[model samples]
Target: MAGPTLRTYKAGSIIYFIEDKGSDVFVLQKGRIILISNSLDSASEIKEDVQKGEFFGVKSALGAYPREETAQVLADSVVLVFTPVMFEAFCTKNPRLVLQMLKVFSGQLRKVHRKVREVLGETGQQENSVELLRTAESFYKMNLKDHANYAFKTFLKNYSTSNFATRGQSMLDMISRGQPYPVEMDSLETIIEKIRLGEMDVSQNAESTNFGDMQMNDVGSMEPPPLDDFSQPEDMHIPDMDDTGLSNDDGSGMMDIPDMDLPDMDIPDMDLPDYTPSMKKPPQMNVPQPSASKPALEGITQFYYDGVNEFSKQNWDVAIKRFEAALSINKFENDAEASFLEKSLFELGRTYMRKGDLTNGIGKLSDFVKKYPRNPNLKKAMAYIAEGYEKKGDKQRAMALYNKVVSMPPRDKESNYAKTQLDRLMK
Candidate 1:
């Protein structure tokens, strides 16, 4: 139940990405912000300018769903950030704000309905249910358990009496029990063979498969049902406001607005949830054993070198794919392979940063630091982590890390770099 906090973002900074967990709402107070999304047809980008004094992230945050668009700072801006509870309280005190938000929500819903109709083209409810169920199955096959869970829940919510509902509920139950969806042994063997022959790219498969895009496509295939069908039973109920109008509880006509250019204020730190993949072993699968001609360690080496080559060429996405493939091979291998694994992880983290995915970058780098505390690249990795924090608007934590680097021994290039950044931040 913490209150709203004011935060600032610089131009060229991303506030959040599509499919990020939506935990807080934002109201633009000054400067410019833009919400970026893909068109329903997936043929173009859609950019919506956020007007001053308007809310941008309300729907997803309130519904406890993933963000549907990316919010980017178009100019240096000040924004008031609110948790869902705080937003509800604010709406209760200013019923007019709720009315305004309703107008925006209605427009968005209408657009979504129209788009769904265009895409589905008179599809029956049964077909819609089947499509949604298939989407959930796709996620399950891809080993994206969380996404599969969400899609299954969405399917059950919309089509609980459909023939597929029982299957969807079964999948949900398995996910809750931490069980992986079953894959055919022959398909698993084929994948392994393709991987060994360099005929398939696991990195490409992992990186290119976007859960949000798949979910959206499934949504487009479904007939738009009544709003009540999607509504949660535990939704918050808003009370009717009396005729006294915008008056405060103490009779003040309206709450005062603060200056847009107010000085930097210290807001409590809000750490984002860690998104590191778990190290659990997958369900056992029987497959043909590998030939002695091509050892498993060789595959790891090839993935690592391929990643390095891609990184050298400035192909961030490809490099990330390769490094992730290498890391996925074996984390508990011998010392030589372990070294390659460590380097692959480090490069993967940096590649993510280059691709503007700071969350995963920081997570991977942090994991590297913890697993290999005495690594030769420890100082460099720490400096990169600090830079990621700085870009993410956590200047205080960034400065603290920079200070640590400056105080470390050897006076290396990384320490020098950290010192330079520290001085710039101090200004």
Candidate 2:
């Protein structure tokens, strides 16, 4: 299918600001975009670079809420802009995308609630205060079940006469009974239908709408199941490999991750290849070398190794943190030291991609290729980027990269994986 219209943005351009009304989602085509936000009173700062194959301005576009952060072009950039109508069609065709977006939005809601709680606590106000009741409702919508439970009960008990008491009562009842807080698949289907039929105008939602003013739609307010795992389609009835072609369909290998209360932190089989870094270092080439910091660089090396160990154990969450620490440590000093920085980026990107965080995943992997073009793993790295692009709905680039990998002379495990994915895509 054809994609949305592309727009160009020069470096230093501001796309939108927090609280600005917006109705279009932007897919980064090239270059960089940065999102910046602070607390309601600008007390704390949060910033993220928009990754290739990632969407920006989605929250505002989806809910008709004001933009929650400021988007600016970090470099000469291109973006494919999808209007609500076009975006809806794109999502219907790629159903997994809807689930993916829900995860993103849920995370966003959780962050907002966290900030709200912090502000209230600093003011010496009870969490259940009337002013904070709406924030509690937001907690529920985000599927932060535990937070919602505490917030709703506090609101109901301490502010019974408050305007939000009735709503809190209903939500609290659901939480008490352990009812599913997330909107069901059928409900989502119905919403899509309404939007397609023009019966639902998502933009009708006001720009000033916040947790307090949002009439709770069927938002889920519980800690959702992990994003990386998903059940297969019931009717398709395929072999165990299922959709992504990644999982082992063999009956005996299917092991559920059990809740273990031990210091050892045993991790279950996640169906990924065994983790092993190549002992063979590539011939050094001329690259822009950044000045390195002292003992801190040592810490970065440690964090990178820790990430590798965590990743092998399928402890993705911890692995991600370790990888991030490695990257953040000393702003990821250039390769004058060792391959730790590049290796960390590679693993971090791969981990995020596995966890359905396509943006950061693509960003890190793309950066790795740019920084280490002549590295021995360049071909493998490009293949990873291809998979990420494929996931992001950029078919042309994905197919081209897959074809490139297949054409390369030496065939490795990465190339074989790419070929498998390419065949799947063609089918």
* Candidate number with greatest TM-score: 1
User: Model 1: runs farther than 4 Å from truth?
Assistant: 1-294, 331-333
Assess every candidate by TM-score: 0.32, 0.31
Per-residue lDDT over 1-427 for candidate 2, one digit per residue giving the tens place of the 0 to 100 score:
5678999999999999888998999999899999999866779988999889998888789889999899989999999999998998999999898899889789978787877867775432433354466567568768798998988888778887553354456557667666543221112222333344553444542110111112223233212212211110001111121221123222221111111111211222212221122211111222212223325545665665556445544567877887777677654344433455666777787776666666666666667666655444555666766766665577777777777767664455456767887898899
What's the TM for model 1? Answer: 0.32
Please report, as a residue range, the 10-residue window in candidate 1 with the lowest summed lDDT.
229-238
lDDT of 1 by residue, 217-332 (tens): 12332332222111100000111211111232232211121111212332323222121111111112222222223345565556665664465455668777777777777543
Which candidate leads the pack in lDDT? 1
